[model samples]
Target chain A: MRVALHLAYNGTHFFGSQTQKETSKTVLGELENVLKKLGIEQKVVASGRTDKGVHATMQVCHIDLPPYWDDMEKLKKVLNKMLCDALHVKKIIHVKDDFHARYSAKKRSYRYIITTKQKNPFESDFVTFLEDVNLQQIQQNIGLFVGEHDFRQFMKTGSDVKSTTRIIYRAFAYQHKDYIVLYFEANGFLRSQIRLMVGALLTLTKDAIQAQLNGTKKYKIKPAPPNGLYLSKIKY
Target chain B: MRVALHLAYNGTHFFGSQTQKETSKTVLGELENVLKKLGIEQKVVASGRTDKGVHATMQVCHIDLPPYWDDMEKLKKVLNKMLCDALHVKKIIHVKDDFHARYSAKKRSYRYIITTKQKNPFESDFVTFLEDVNLQQIQQNIGLFVGEHDFRQFMKTGSDVKSTTRIIYRAFAYQHKDYIVLYFEANGFLRSQIRLMVGALLTLTKDAIQAQLNGTKKYKIKPAPPNGLYLSKIKY
Candidate 1:
């Protein structure tokens, strides 16, 4: 039977969500290790891959399980016990055999957190600290990416994708206590898309951003660090 | 010249605040390693030592420096550059030659954070989450720790302290958004005393807590984990 697992990970411990060659630590590699120990040699597929140092609060994945692992509660307990604290299976449910974690997703949401306060040791890993920022300026330009556009310039330099066009369902900025959160919802995003958009929002003017969205201006934009980015949700 | 430095450390990457024999990744050990590289071979004296995984936001330490390293700003910049991200020197100021970090401290403040929400990977290291807790009961019992008392029962075993009694200037609990913060201000604290007191506050009845403070009750109380405890401030 196939199972859909709701997962959450700190992401600081793992190299990234995707498994890599050689014995590098990644989210899938760690999960598969525990599954093999439980006598279930199955591969886990994530909804999407997250970059290194990125966190996830509601990342979904699909895995096939044997008949003996019918008790979902017991399976979740066992998985959590064996997995390290940085990774966890929040919930597990039976899914249709054809349900694919990556392909069946209709929407994905990402959030980038920014702190204007002085950098503190406790929050350094989760929130990006900026010495100076114009909140009103960023908020005004964030809505420019709300509609569908070809985000070819915003994609990471070396990534290969057949299509660079994606729909942005929603994009906005809000203040939550001490942090400013940038929320982006889309049907899909290219590699490093959100970070690049956030970087553009921080550095480029309104006209520059529009030119980039129009694919008329090609500027070398640096993607924001992954520490402040979180894969918040995936909807099917 | 003697200089007092205000420091902050995440503590998750550190074994403890004090230096240990062999190659241990300790706060002082890391700090001293950087100091030695700067050619300042003086030992650092902290206001107090925190247990493994106990964080500090304003831990003060005193170190004597050579006259060649007279630029305080330059010294701070060099120190921060050499130290790891988990450890930082927040501020530096010259002090009298007789000044000492531990001996001159008049009061120390510690804060314990408790979250009633479900455990999440993002906040697992900074906040202690409990599934079920009677907040009102813990609040009412926390006041019993105020004032002077024989806290021998609340200290960690095998700790060779000169005295077990200390004056508690203030003790209270307050709500901070999603967290319940327990604050304690005292002239001094024995090793793991706050954690033990917090454990009793959570588990023991009000009468039992009073008995423990009076030295009439001796319960083998397990101290709360160090991850949720922070050495917030030290006043001299």
Candidate 2:
């Protein structure tokens, strides 16, 4: 039987979502370890990969289970008991065998959190602290991202892809208490795309952002720190 | 010049707030290192010592400063720059020559947070997760802790104190969003007193708690984990 699991993790200590040769602390690596403990050796698939120090509130993944572990409640309880310290399985749903966690997803949403307040020790892992930011100006120009554009320059360099163009369905910013959240929804994103875009939003003017989106100009801006980015949701 | 500094720290990685003979990662150890770097060798004092894995929002400490470091703002900025990762110096204030962080303090307030929601990775360091807790029942019995009582049973064993009697000025429980915060204001606390009190509140009935407060009975409940404990404030 095939099933999809909704997962959440605080990725501060994780290397990334994908497995690595040097360590087994990656999201999939940890999940695979627990699955192996249960005598289920099937591979798990994720909807997308999040970078190191990035968090996820609603990441989806899928896996095949053997006939002996047909009880969903028992599986979830056992999985949580084993993996509750670093990762959480929010819910498990039975899905069609043909459904793929990556290819079947239509939209993905990410949120970037920035705080204007002074840096504190407890919340530093989850929020980016910036001083003297004009949130109103950023909100006014954030709509430039709400359309299809060639995002090659906005992604980390040296990546090979068939196309650099992708469709962005929505983009906006809102203030929640002392933090400002930047929300983006797109069909797909390139490697380090959202962080790079946020870096541009913080450093570039309206014309520079437009020129970069139009692929007519280039800017040298490092991507924002991954601690502030969260893979919020995915739709299938 | 005598000075009082307001400090806050996330004690997850720290052994405790006091300095240790073997290491320098304790709250005072780290602060002393930064002070020594600036050529000031005066020892720093804290209002009280918090145990391992406890957090603080407003902890007060005092030290005598050299004549060279007269500007309070610059001193705070330099201190924060050196210790921003694990500890923070929120502000610095000048005080009378006789002021003492430990001796002059009158009251301290602490908050223990418990959540009925499912366990998640992000908030485990700040909140405790419990199943099927009745906040109202705990609230009803919490008032018995107010006023003077012998809290010898609530303290950890092997702790030698001058007296086991202490005054709890206020005790109550309130709901905030998905969290239930148990607030305690006291003249002072014995070693692990608050955590053990919370443990008994969750497990013992009203009569058991009353008996424990009256020093007539003893229970063997383990102290609650320190991750959910925070020293919130100190009144001079």
Candidate 3:
């Protein structure tokens, strides 16, 4: 039987979402460990990888389970008990055998939050605080990210990817209390593109760039720090 | 000039609220270091000490500065920027020489929170999650805490305070979403008294103890773990 799990985690302690040798603290690794405790192994796959210190509000993953374990309510309880803290299993549902968490994803949305208020120790692990940023400028710069563009310049240099062009469905920036939240949705993204765009936007807002510099001209955008970015949702 | 600063900190990273020779990574120590950078040294004092892993929503402290440095707004910004991310200065105000951070307090309030749902990493530093708590039973037991009471049995063994009796102006437990928030206001508290009360209440709610096991009787009550308690508010 095929199963889909909607989940979220605070990524501060993980290496990243993808599994790596020796350092098996990734979200997938933890999920797999819990699955192993339930007598299942080698049956899980995630929607995508999130960089270290990145957070997620909703991420989808698919797993293959035995036919006898069909009661999702009981499974959720068991999983919740086993997973305990740090990770949460929001929902569980049976999916078509051929459904893929990565391929079936219609759009991915991300948010980057920056704060100017004095440090909030309670939220330090989840948000990035910037001492300087002009609100009006950041709101203005987000408009440039709404359309499709050749985002090779936004991609990290060492990222292994063939294409750099992607369609951005929506992009905007707004203030939520003390935080400046940058919201972006796209059919897909090049590696580190969101972070890069955020970094560039912050730079633009700070007036770090000269007036003659064109931020959207493909060669000038820099990736934002990883801590501020969160994979907020994935639509299937 | 004398200034009293209202502050808050996540005590998980600090040893506690007070600075000691062996445990110098304390909230007061960090603030003192920042003060030294501004040419003020050894002139800091806090209202009281909060134990390790005990958070504060509002902790008060006072420091003496040069008479010429009378700009409260500038001092606030300077200290907030200089302090580490784990400590924050919420508000600063110039006060008369007679004002003492510790002695000027009229009352102190604390809130202990416990969640019946799965652990939330976002709130890990702020709240405690108890797996099996009957909210209805806990709610019913809350009325037992109101008014003044001799709380000797509810306090820790080595507490050498002058009095065990305290005036509780408010005491109640309420459910908010997945969490149960327990609030208490008192002239003062004996060490570990709130934690002990909470632990006993949880046990009673779970049927681990008979309903007759109130602290009013001569009985020993175990203190809940330190992570569940917070020095939520200190009034001056």
Candidate 2: residue B41 lDDT (0-100): 92
lDDT of 3 by residue, B1-236 (tens): 77899998887768888887886689998888888888888657887778888888888989888887888888888888888777888889988898888888778888888876666666666677776887778777766767788777777788788878888888888888877888888887777778877887876543333333344345456667676677777777
Q: DockQ (C-alpha) of model 1?
A: 0.53
Q: List the candidate numbers ranked by DockQ, top first.
A: 2, 1, 3
What does candidate 1's lDDT look like per residue over B48-102, in tens digits? 9998889998899999998898899999988887787788899999999999999
Clashing pairs in 3: A195-A224, A196-A223
Clashes of 2: 0
Best first by TM-score, ranked: 2, 1, 3
**Top TM-score model:** 2
Whole-model lDDT values for every prediction: 0.91, 0.91, 0.79
Can you tell me the CAPRI class of model 2? Answer: medium
User: How would the docking of model 1 be graded?
Assistant: medium
Q: List the residue pairs that clash in candidate 1.
A: none
Ten residues in a row with the worst lDDT in model 2 chain A?
A83-92
Each prediction's number of clashing residue pairs: 0, 0, 2
**In candidate 1, which residue ranges exceed 4 Å CA deviation?**
A19-26, A29-41, A67-85, A88-90, A135-178, A204-220, B20-25, B29-41, B66-90, B135-178, B204-220
Compared with the true structure, model 2 gives a TM-score of 0.87
Of candidate 3 chain A, the 10-residue stretch with the lowest lDDT total is A206-215
